[model samples]
Target: MNAKELHDKTPDQLREELSNLKKESFNLRFQQATGQLENPAQIKIARRAAARVKTVLNQKAAAAAATE
Candidate 1:
């Protein structure tokens, strides 16, 4: 998912997306630990995606706070 898509989602949807990304990241780490990970780059990609979602979420929160 891209930042544009994330930015369009409501906070609840963004939270759900973040949760799924975290689960994927955890599973990737477990696979790497067992030496069964075929693509180590996936871990990095997932981490970044999670970070992107977080950045969008924070931006949304800041915008809301500024309006209040």
Candidate 2:
């Protein structure tokens, strides 16, 4: 998903997405180890997507904490 779509998702949803992405990343790694992975660059893209979700989640948490 794109940054705009990621930003629009609720925190809980973002967390869920992050978890799923991590799982996918793990699977991708396994595929690579077995020499079955196609488009190895997908690993990097998945990692970046997870990072984006995390960054947004962190920003939201910080904002919430600041308000209280």
Candidate 3:
């Protein structure tokens, strides 16, 4: 997922996405530890996606604070 896409989602949606990404990241790490991971790159992708969602969520929170 991209930052732009994440920015378009509501905070609740972003939180859900972040949670899912984290779960996937954890699973990927487990797979890697067991040496059964097919694509190790996915771990990095999921991490970055979670970060993007977080960034967007922070931005939204900041914007809301500013408006208030």
Q: How do the residues 1-68 of candidate 2 rate in per-residue lDDT, one tens digit apiece?
A: 88889888899999999999999999999999999998999999999998989999998899889999
Clashes of 3: 0
Superposition-based RMSD of candidate 1 using all C-alpha atoms, in angstroms: 0.5
RMSD of 3: 0.6
Candidate 3 residue-wise lDDT, 1-68, digit = tens: 77778878999999999999999999999999999999989999999988888899999999999999
For each candidate, what TM-score against the reference?
0.97, 0.94, 0.96
RMSD of each: 0.5, 0.7, 0.6
Report the number of the highest-lDDT candidate: 1
Candidate 3 similarity to native, TM-score: 0.96
- Candidate 2, superposed: residue stretches over 4 Å from native: none
Better of 1 and 2 by TM-score: 1
Best by TM-score: 1
